[model samples]
Target chain A: MDQREQGKAIVITSGKGGVGKTTTTANLGTALALLGKKICLIDADIGLRNLDVVMGLENRIVYDLIDVVEEQCRLEQALIKDKRNENLVLLPAAQTRDKDAVSEEQMKELILKLKERMDYILVDSPAGIEQGFRNAIAGADKAIIVTTPEVSAVRDADRIIGMVEAEGVNDPDLIINRIRQDMVDRGDMMNIEDMIEILAIDILGVVPEDEGIVVSTNKGEPIVLSNNHKAGEAFNNIARRLEGEDVPLMDLNNSDSILAKFKKFVGLS
Target chain B: MSAVIKTKIEEQGVILSFNPDYCWEEITSALAEHLQEGAQFYQGSKLYFDLAFKDWRAEELQNLINLIESNILPETDFYFMNQSSGVERDNKATPKEQPFSPRSAQENKYTKTAGNDTKLIQRTLRSGQSIEHMANLVLLGDVNPGAEIKAGGDIIVFGKLMGLVHAGATGDKGAAITALQLAPTQIRIASVISRSPDEDKSKELRPERAYIKNNRIVVEEVNL
Candidate 1:
């Protein structure tokens, strides 16, 4: 493989909170690892660490990103190997500290060192347009903006996109999460077209509202590992798209039935 | 050569002057025609006229000013100056700074009855950022997907309105939202909340207006 292709650092962020930025980062990191690629996920939300717990590696973190940046520990010592996959590692944030503990220069240096060993470096950015968000996106080669179908979420996503663009990150892709199909059919919620038209950015994927995602996160297991969930399959498709595959979108309109599969195959509603 | 028209803008008003080498009559006629062609663009804007190095008499200068003023759209300010009259080099007369405030005196005239009734927001309300204004609110740019706005009166977006908007947020019931593209994620007028339909099958994409009618948010096409 080309040395430049060894690692591609991507930051998953949203301008608004509670829109699945960490969840998307964790799932995408795991999904990419399952494809036999060596992946390292960095939880850049320093003060409020959650990616490690979502990835089920919180208990195993004896050293963290701050320790490595502060030179209290070696980079290898801070890398926590996942129980499910040895190839997947996590650099958890320090929960006891704040975002100020890590500077933008330190994040860039850490990602540079990880680039030498990993195939992908996924950073989970904290919500808001503050220093924490800037720190998370400092060393990113690309950014993934996660949002929901709701109006508030889309508005924040647009503002974040504008900010990122102003910082010279152009063409950031979008991921619309927590879309409820029934509500969409009933005209109670904004649909995918409404989001795409307003945001006007390239869409990475759309994840449906899956209860399995909530349960899996509670158990410290990524939903992507559960093949039974529609959200899981949607995330897997997103991973494939990231890997440059042209897989068609999952038929979310007619989910959970054989007829849905038939509809997906026929490319019809 | 391009027309060399001189304008001296000041705090009091704009003053107009023309170069003696240029055709004053032709240029003045051209300016009047241009103003007529694009009245809305010049309306309410301030300009100063400078007649430097021109030998035109005071009566001629007055006639030019009157013609320009007559051609100008409503609310526009025009000031005239002539070098012959020694008003061009008056150091004490300073040009007014371009008004940076969103609301101007003329705009205020339209909104005075609603005095101090309009709210001005200067920052981009990011996702999770929300603002509730007791009166009419105007945004300079987009209201992103995760952001929200609630105003007691009309809401106008100089840019896109992509987030949730609640006009007449306190149940005034007659509030409306107008935008370059009114594809809001969620819109509410009084007690009614509605979302824009999916764009895949919906073809009627144009500038639109949303208002409350019979306790429901109704969207209608708007012609610019």
Candidate 2:
């Protein structure tokens, strides 16, 4: 662990709204913390924060990003510690101010200050190519773009990929969220292959559409905290990948035979 | 009336050659007629208005953009270049040269110009990326869906051609398009346009060529 000099900052962004950027940030941060890495989650959505609530740390936030930027509160005082995991903390966004309240320089400075003390900093960006989106990616070294299988989401994801590349973050990883394997098998939804063909990017992980995500969100606990759900396992795999571990994608069909058959069909086995 | 607006398919989009003699209404009505006649040709491609050296009020230009967006090409992206509000846009205006100019005056005497400038691209064109060349285009990689390539001469793809491509964009009629695996969302040659079937009918992959024959675009397998 001491071999690592400084932490890596990753900004998770999706050009479209409601594709689960916040949920992913909360869950990935929690999963990384479970792996014994100190994680700091930043809600950069400003005036529309959701990571704190999703992580069940909404009530513990006594100060926020704006408070720290304005020097009204110390950076340490603004960070809210996780109840379950002592290694995880969250810097909640300011609900009262818009994205204009924090400049890109201020956001970068704040992340730089936190980088010395953490192993990974995950920034949850807001939707659209606006000031908020720019401010979110300003301090990041890596990017994780989230998109669904729907055509609109994929199109927006492509646009976001272009924008991210233009902003000097090259070859950002993709996470396909809310993919329904049943619909894909029925030929009703775009499959993962079709998406990869169009987006032309490397996939980080694919999360199946699970109702347990809603239950976990309502309970204010990330699904990764639970052991029974496949979605939780998928997130845990993502955390392991971030830790420089090579983990095969979980079989969404919940069977080894079908995946084995697929591997054989593709001549991979 | 036909000379009021000359629509030319370029890489950026459709460039409407502005004739300074016509009034705004006449130009727009002519443009509307052109769009109606080739609505299928202009579909899925952005429209660009090159108002050469013309100074119009901002509101008037906005009205034109609004009319086109609301009435025609609603799904298409519309843009206007080289226009200034009240001020003379002299610097932006370059003298309109004849599009796809022949190499030499002596070459004009022959029925067919022997050489057309060809542009070669070496990488896969992803979605939202576009390539427009005034002559020929040779791509060495895949043209993914949502990407477009417009060329005035011919288009040859050494890899899969899955995106939109317009050959003979200057109305050459003799221009052709060929690809190793041609399954494009849409293909246009000269003034004709065709789209892929709703379902991919053919299970076999083959190198194919597309060209205008008897005023319609025809696709046939070509042996390399």
For model 1 chain A, give the 10-residue run with minimal summed lDDT.
A260-269
Candidate 1 interface RMSD (Å) = 18.5
**Relative to the unseen true structure, what is the C-alpha lDDT of residue B178 in candidate 2, on a scale of 0 to 100?**
97
Candidate 2 local lDDT, B3-25, one digit each (tens):
57666555334676667787877
CAPRI category for model 1 = incorrect
TM-score of each: 0.53, 0.52
The DockQ assigned to candidate 1 is 0.01
Q: Backbone collision count in every prediction?
A: 24, 1
What 10-residue stretch in candidate 1 chain B is worst by lDDT? B97-106
TM-score of chain A of 2: 0.93
Candidate 2 DockQ, CA atoms: 0.01
lDDT per residue, candidate 2, A181-234, as tens digits?
788999999998899999998888988888999998877899999877777877
How close is chain A of candidate 1 to the true chain A, as a TM-score? Answer: 0.95
